[model samples]
Target: MQNLLSIVIIGIGATAVMDLWGALRKPLLGVPPPNYAMLGRWIAHMTHGQFCHKSIAASPSIAAEQIIGWVAHYLTGIAFAALLIGISGPAWIQNPTMGPAFAVGTGTIAAPFLLMQPGMGAGFAGSKMPNPNAARLQSLLTHMAFGLGLYLSGLAVSLIC
Candidate 1:
């Protein structure tokens, strides 16, 4: 139960980090505000591998993608917390140590950089975008934010719990 809460918090924090990362990197040539929610949804859809990809805006197939993505996002939150609990055990669940939390955040980079980008037809890290370098930098920053989010969420949970 507590582990579940931890994941929820971490996921929220990850979203927050994503926002900050985008704002920070907005000046970068090719970086766009990454859809952190998309990351979440991707995590969720990975469980099924059914290509559920949706966004909050209007585009071709946006509805299917967004719904699947939203569900996947929440699932990612749960999964992240579960992994943290598994690694630290129940005792840590009560007071998640920072290492595992940050590790989880750091670990989040794999999906976008490797799987999502290529799958989205962006090559790797927005290579398909006009400014691939800026796009790649945006991705890196967003992932780093996710890592920071993990640590921040863990700290919050440890303190509150």
Candidate 2:
């Protein structure tokens, strides 16, 4: 129970940090935040046995996609946190080091590059986007931020727990 609580706290904290970065990036870099509604739509379609789309934007909209997307976002973050804990073990959670946290956080980019992007019709690693290189760079940076968040969150958890 303690370990579970620690994982959940760490995950939410890390994901919140990543979200903070996104909020800051908009005004500072003129980069728009991701549209989670599309993610929700994609997830909603999964219930109907649809995993891939030619263009998620062009696909039919689902009810409460925004809410669903945000929930999925947080759940995904929690899952990633669990993955980090599973790989690093309970000892790491107690110690809260940066190396392992970063390794797991940065490694998570594969999900979007291989599965989420392609499934949403953005092509592999956003290759189909108008600015593929830019998209790739953004994704890399975002994941790195997530890695940093994981480390920071881990540190917080270590201090608290």
21-116 per-residue lDDT for model 1 (tens digits): 667765764445656445544445555564433331221333356566656655665576566667767576456566776776667767766777
The candidate maximizing TM-score is 2
TM-score of 2: 0.97
CA lDDT, every prediction? 0.62, 0.91
In model 1, the runs with Cα more than 4 Å from the true position are 27-31, 35-59, 64-71, 94-98
Q: Could you tell me how far off, in angstroms, the CA of residue 124 lies in candidate 2 after the best superposition? A: 0.4
Q: Lowest lDDT 10-mer window, candidate 2?
A: 16-25
Q: What residue pairs clash in candidate 1, if any at all?
A: 40-73, 41-73, 44-72, 53-65, 54-65, 54-66
lDDT of 2 by residue, 75-101 (tens): 888899999999999888889889988
Residue 111's lDDT in candidate 1: 71
Prediction 1 global C-alpha lDDT: 0.62
